[model samples]
Target: MQEIFDENVFKKGIGRQINLPFLKAVSTAFKNIRVRFGRSFITIGGIFFSLTFLMSTFTNNVIAQSLLASGTDEVKFLLQPMAQEVQARQVWLISLSLLVCIIGIMNAMLTSVTERYREIGTWKCLGALDRFIVELFLLESTFQGLIGSIGGAILGFLFPLFVNIGKYGTQVIEVLPWLEILKYGAITIVIGLVLSIAGAIYPAYRATQMVPADAMRQEM
Candidate 1:
């Protein structure tokens, strides 16, 4: 009724390198994402929304500063630097958004662990190590985060730009800090990746602790 790992093979493998390749873990992560499309979508969307808000505010602030630095009387009439209190409020909002996104991701991953009880058990039975399980979870979250953050960063940057263009005319494009925008975009992407990986850490650790027999017996 049940097939467990071969005791002899398990015993022999104790002295050898049996950890799965990183590429294999990555492949499995991709498959998991494809299989759990809806959950993956929500997880990615949360990351996207958070990063979009972050990038948009930063872009807007940068735009205001650039317009001011242009030394045009028009800039004074058209835009004003954000007040200190306003900037502080925006910072609070951004921090809250990111925190919510991380919590959402953590919940999604934990649900995944519960749903894939049998699958995880099978992997362990076939010699998959705890580290492999952890790697898979991290890879999954990172992939989702990478896609979401990149999309968010581009959308966030462009949306404010378009709005500014309407307000300041196409000439406003010439005044933007292109180099600075690129730098911030790069930093935002890194933050997204770190955020997703951090969210998955606890879930990944949970996956590693599953007992093969108990997990296989679980009903998803």
Candidate 2:
């Protein structure tokens, strides 16, 4: 049941673009908002749990650091175990972040293509060039990507501060950190834009193959 919630909520596809460029953008942005606030919290939960475990381990091994300081052989033996756990945690963090981003981009692109199939067919039948059709989708996808990426980036950066606000108090959470947001946003948008174009390829091709009469007959 818990897994089902994660699949339905934190996972993408619920909120999607409606074919209008800006509205599509807004829908994609909302999905990211859901991901950042929802999916990320779940992914980070394990990290927090592991950190707690590590803290307990450290408390139990109070003499561990002291042993290393004294160059004891036993301390040297424990180093590998500590290092391995830390490395594993780092890998999990990076992997989960990548997974979320990939999932979000793929979801947005696939949904966009699915909704615009008939529109693509119509364009193809009206003597629209293949390149034009491709470019048109690319532009719309890019626009959607830009909105989601920018909003997600901002939300991601400020999110930690927002969560920590109660603990850290208002004074410490001063800046919004725009530069970092833009950097990450640019990267995400580029990935999403590319994914959007790639996702459209098959759909666009199918649309291109439609006979004019058949395309005209497709239910709009």
Tell me, by TM-score, which candidate is best: 1
Candidate 2 lDDT over 11-95, as tens digits, reads 4543431233544445644554454454334322322333223222322232233333443365457554675575557566655
Which residue pairs clash within candidate 1? none
RMSD of each: 4.6, 17.0
Q: Candidate 2, 218: how far from true, in Å?
A: 3.3
lDDT of each: 0.89, 0.46
Q: TM-score per candidate, in order?
A: 0.90, 0.45
Q: After superposition, how far is residue 90 of candidate 1 from its true place, in Å?
A: 0.8
Cα lDDT for residue 86, model 1? 63
| Candidate closest to the true structure, highest lDDT | 1
Q: Cα lDDT for residue 217, model 2?
A: 67
lDDT for model 1 = 0.89
Model 1 collision count: 0
